[model samples]
Target: MVRRLPFLLGGIALFLVNALTLSIGFGFGLSGVPAALLIAAPVVLCWYRPMAAWWLALAGLLLLTLLGPVLSDDEALQYRPWLLNAIPAHLAVVYVLALSVRLRIAIPAFVIYLAAGALTPIHLLDDLPNAIAGAIVWAMAVLVAMVLGHNKRVRLTSTLRIAEERGRRLVLEERNRIARELHDMVAHHMSVIAVQTATARYRLPGGVSEEASREFQAINATARESLREMRHLLGVLRDPADPAETEPPPQGLADLPRLMESARRAGTPVRLAVVDTPDPLSPAAALTAYRIVQEALSNVVRHATGAATRVEVAPDETCSALIVEVHNAPPDAPPPAVERPHPGHGLVGMRERVAVHGGDMTAAPTPEGGFIVRATLPLASSTGAGEPSPDVMDGGDGRDTSDDQRIDRR
Candidate 1:
């Protein structure tokens, strides 16, 4: 009700102003009460029905002009040009028509208004200038209203387009982030499993059972198949603008030693340790472990360079899972100057990686004014033959690898 108050007040004001002009015709006794009512009907009806109001106003003006000589008394001839009084009401109606209707209706109504001015016979010789001036004013008002309405529509369309583009950009950014996390957490592990199984099978100790050797071969074959499928999946996820040939392989636990050496050369001292275990980690678990340590050390290098950092990788003694922790001491000096702001998607990516493996992770400030990140990834179960399940092979698909096809020919 409160929101509607302004419209109500505006409609009442329009009716009263049109009523005032109609009252002049009544005072001159040019037409009786009935004709006066007809002239005022459109003004009152315009609030409820604009199109009908336009027709009604035009008809009433024409009716009054045709009947003018008959309705006026001899004394009223002194004010013979009674149609002049209706000029304001007619202009108001034209303005409303242009504002509320489409161009087809509005343009015709304007044309009719000019036609009425020229055809109405009630105009005296002295009233010609006033009639011409009134028509000019009405045309200007209608044109201004149409121009404003067009501009408002264009602005509204432009604003909606901008909002839609912003939404599309946000969706693309989210897809790219998911692709990055998959590359870091899944591809890395698959690469490691393929490399390790191939090397371990040939390096087996003497007198190993033939069945054991077969199982190792099967595991090696499955890992390699999974790696090929992973590459295809990555290709699908990668942006089309990125060249596949230029893309590098994912890094894993095997890359830790080189990463540590590079950090040391960059002036950040670090220590690395891995606990021995008889059973190796699943590809997903190993990749999750590697990413956690990688992101943690990256944080240290960016925010706490020159700090002493320790990276620990080991199997959890209490459960069939791998535990990874990266702890760093406070920086000896302030961080180096940076060229751009960090978007801070690193921690989010770590959590996503851990969650994918049904693992838990935490990154928080330690009591010693340093930062520590810890993650535990539960190892997936293997088949009785010591191989990952067929579903795990090729990452839940039976897609044959081109590499395996080439190997078979060899």
Candidate 2:
């Protein structure tokens, strides 16, 4: 409705002005008022009822052409040619029809207008050149209106296509993320069960009874069955159309040491610390914590090369949640600002991960010219089990003891 406002206002103004001009020129008598109303009807009706407007315009043109001599004195008739008087209403009807109806309907109306002009008696058959010129000009105005309507339809179709493509892309990305989360949650528990069962079987004393050994074997079998069911469930959640694409399982806190080692090798000096004894984390919370640190380190590597970073993980005193923080100092010689990639998608991905687990995360610049990312993931009662599993680390302290490289910067 709002889109039609400009056309409505412009049409009313044009019709009123034309009607007043013609009435004043003809001395405002009974004949002049009726003729002026005939001229103005098409433009006014074009706004609400365009098809009716076209019919009214044709009737007005035919009336003026046939009775023009009787309605006006010779002086008034000589002042304006019949063709000139008909042009405004004729053009207004054609323009509105072209925009409001299909080409099949609008073209026939134009043909009817031409037939009416041919039947009129005012034009002398001997004046062939003038009649031909007038017909050509009227046809050209109708053609212009058709071209304008065609361009508008083309632009609207293109806009709708672009919007549809964007919506599909967003839905595909979200499905992929959900698949990743499911794989991470199920795979982590299965891995822990497998590793723990194998370790217990190997560490058993030589004098162990046959009954205890069979029980160990039974536990291992149960864990393997659970893992097989998990794989089938994950397959159902994945996109069936793209069977060739497979997503790897997501990493957790256990993978942090390897991630830090990779960053160190990439030339960023990193320090790791765990202030309190680490507790076993649920798969969702662990994945969220890992992703936050991963994205933060990735940003530092991409934007703040030659900088030093620190990663800290500690359990809350109440054992209700785990706090994780990744901090990176500004590079000794900062890179150009334009060299940094736009941070839109990466930050959005991090926020989505945190929101899924109902965690709070913040990334901000520090007072001493550095960047820090802090996250707190709420812990569930089922997450508190034994100590950190051996599959993630081999030592009691949650620190990587691999080769460390020290670099000195001025």
Candidate 3:
């Protein structure tokens, strides 16, 4: 309704002018109502079907020209080409015509309408000064309407193009980020494969044949070559300005105690619990879980300061997946602008991370007026195996908050 307000208002204004023209009758008896509808309906309909409404407006002009208004008032008879009260109504149709068509169509349409308007006067030279002056005024009206409409069309098209380009760029950047993360995860496993193959002869209980040893050497070389290709690919995905190669590796599940401790220091009361298992998470899953919790905690601190927050990580009922959840209670007293809502950029990134690993996640406001986010990442030996079991750190700010930590219960 809000979007249609301008059109609705314009329709009513034009309708009223046509209504006044009908009330005066001006020589056509009961037939003027059809002419009035032809002039007025176009104002409302032109938004959806400009060309059709333009034809209707033209028909109304033709009707007025054929049955010229026979009025006693000399001043009123002067605007016969427009039928006096219909000028505004007809001008609106021309404006919309400019908006609806290309420059070739709009420019030629304006010329045809202006020429027709000038030629349609019942008596062209009876009042020479008024005739010349009316032509200038009418030409200006038509010219301004088309110019404004054409510029408006160009401006709207540019804005739509800009939005589309921005969306495409954001999508490409996100794909690169996901690619870098996968490369880092796969590179770790490939390095392990190379190491294991290199040591097979020494580690195996039974002595291997010379042929078996050669096969092991071949596997090691292949793994190393694959790692090199991935590294080259990672370089391509990374930005030239990024110093990420020198930065410390990103934190994973093992870093959560420290994360919770920082949230605690930020004035959010927080607790964590980790259920240990013999099976370990793929580096990608651990990092993604760690990021989800980190972002959830950050949002709690920003939007619900002093909220009691809990972070939990454990296997689901069947033990085939890891379930990580973060829940925050409502704040006691939010800071200025803290409660103001924002677009959830953090949640979107977390969802993308989970999606890349074929996981499902949900983030929504809680009935308690806080927020909760839960992610389920599938697990299997083929997906993730040799990473060490996560152990709680004495949370660097170096105080051991044993009461707040989950002692890895195997």
Best by lDDT: 3
Between candidates 1 and 3, name the one with more favorable TM-score: 3
After superposition, which runs of candidate 2 have C-alpha atoms over 4 Å from their true positions?
A: 1-6, 26-70, 74-93, 116-129, 189-410
Error of 1 at 259 (Å): 0.9
Model 1 segments more than 4 A misplaced: 1-236, 241-247, 341-344, 382-410
Clashing residue pairs, backbone N/CA/C < 3 A, model 1: none
The clash numbers for all candidates, in the given order, read 0, 0, 0
Q: For candidate 3, lDDT tens digit of each residue in 126-195?
A: 5667766776687788789889888888887889899788656655665777688778778889999999
Candidate 1 has its poorest 10 consecutive residues by lDDT at 401-410
Residue by residue across 171-284, what tens digits does model 2's lDDT show?
455446656576756777777887677567567666446787677667878888888887887777666764453545446776778777767766678777654434456667
Taking all chains together, each candidate's TM-score versus the true structure is 0.40, 0.45, 0.69
Specify the poorest-scoring 10-residue window by lDDT in model 2: 401-410
What lDDT does candidate 2 reach at residue 314? 69
